[model samples]
Target: MGSEVHECHLVCGPPAAGKTRYARVLADRLGACLLDSDQVTERLVRAGLLLAGRDPDDRDSVAYKEAYREPVYETLFELAREHLPRGPVIIVGPFTREGGEPDGLAGLEGKVGQNVIAHFVWCDPDERKRRIEMRGETRDLPKLADWDGYLTSCREDRPCWPHRFVDTT
Candidate 1:
C-alpha cells in the first residue's frame, strides 16, 4: 500500500468575501491547516513595531502603518514553501487583480511544483456587504471603493490562474 500525495489549496478572493470562513470549513473537513492573511497581518500589527494608524505617505518611518505587509507576505511564502513537505495547506487571502498583472498563483505553482490548487471564492456585492456587516460591528462599506468595478475586473480581465470559482453567497 502506498500513501497518497497531498496537494496545496490556495483560497483567494476579495476582502470580506468569506474566504476565511470557507477555508475554515474546508480545513475542518479535510484536516488541513488554514493560513489566513488578515489574521497574519493582525498578528504582525500586534507586535508593536507597526503602529495602529500612521501616514501611509511617510517615506522614512520604520514604524509606519502598512509597513508589515512586505514582511508578512514574505513570511507567508516562506511558510507555504515549508509546509509543502507536510502535505496540503490552505491559504486564505485577497489575491486581487491589479492593472492586468499576473496573480501570484504561477509563482506559487512553480515553487511547489505542480501540486497546487487555486480556488477563487466569489460572492455577490449585496451579500458581501451583508456579510461584512454581520461579521464586524465597525464595518464601513464606504471604505470599500468601487466594489462593482473591482468585481467586474476580477471576473473579466484577471489572468487565468488554473482556479476554481466557488460562490458561497
Candidate 2:
C-alpha cells in the first residue's frame, strides 16, 4: 500500500516566532521531514561563512546571502519537490518579513509546480523580544529607533500568504 502524500508547508514569521518548534511538531504530525533555516545558516557560519545576519548593508553580503540563503531555500524546495512524489516536507524559517519576498517564493512554487502552502506565525513584539532573550540572542534584540522602525517595516511589508498567527506569549 502506498502512503498518503501531503503538500509542502512553508512555515515563516518574524524572529523568535517558534517556526522551528512548530514545524517539527507539524512534520511529526503529518509524517513529513522538517527543514530548518537556522540549522542551515549555523552550518554555514560554522564553516567560516557569514550569512545575512553579519553585515546587511555590505555589498559582499550578497555573496554570503546567495551562497547560504539561496541554497537553503533552493535545496528545501528541491527536497520538497523530490518528496512530493512520495510525501510531504515542512520548511521552517523566518523567511523574514523583510528578506523573503513573494516573487522568490513564487518562483520556488513555480519550480515545484503547485502543492505548496505558506504559513506565518505572528507574535506580539514584547513576546518576540522575550523569546529572543530566552534563546540568548541579544545582539538583534529590536533596539534603537532605527532598528525598531526597520523591524516594523519588515513586519508591515510581509507578503500576505496563507498564514496562521500563533501566540507564543
lDDT of 1 by residue, 1-169 (tens): 2354666888877666678888999888888877786676654544444364543223223453246645655666667767656767787766553213465676766654556788788777778767766766332343244555545534332236567888877
Among residues 3 or more apart in sequence or in different chains, the pairs in candidate 1 whose N, CA or C atoms overlap within 3 Å are none
User: How high is the CA lDDT of each candidate model?
Assistant: 0.62, 0.63
Error of 1 at 56 (Å): 11
* 90-140: candidate 2 lDDT, tens digit per residue: 877666632355475676567666756777777777776667667764335
TM-score (all chains, Cα) for each model? 0.71, 0.71
- Report the poorest 10 consecutive residues by lDDT, candidate 1: 56-65
Best by lDDT: 2
- Candidate 1 regions with alpha-carbon error over 4 angstroms: 1-5, 46-66, 98-103, 111-114, 137-159
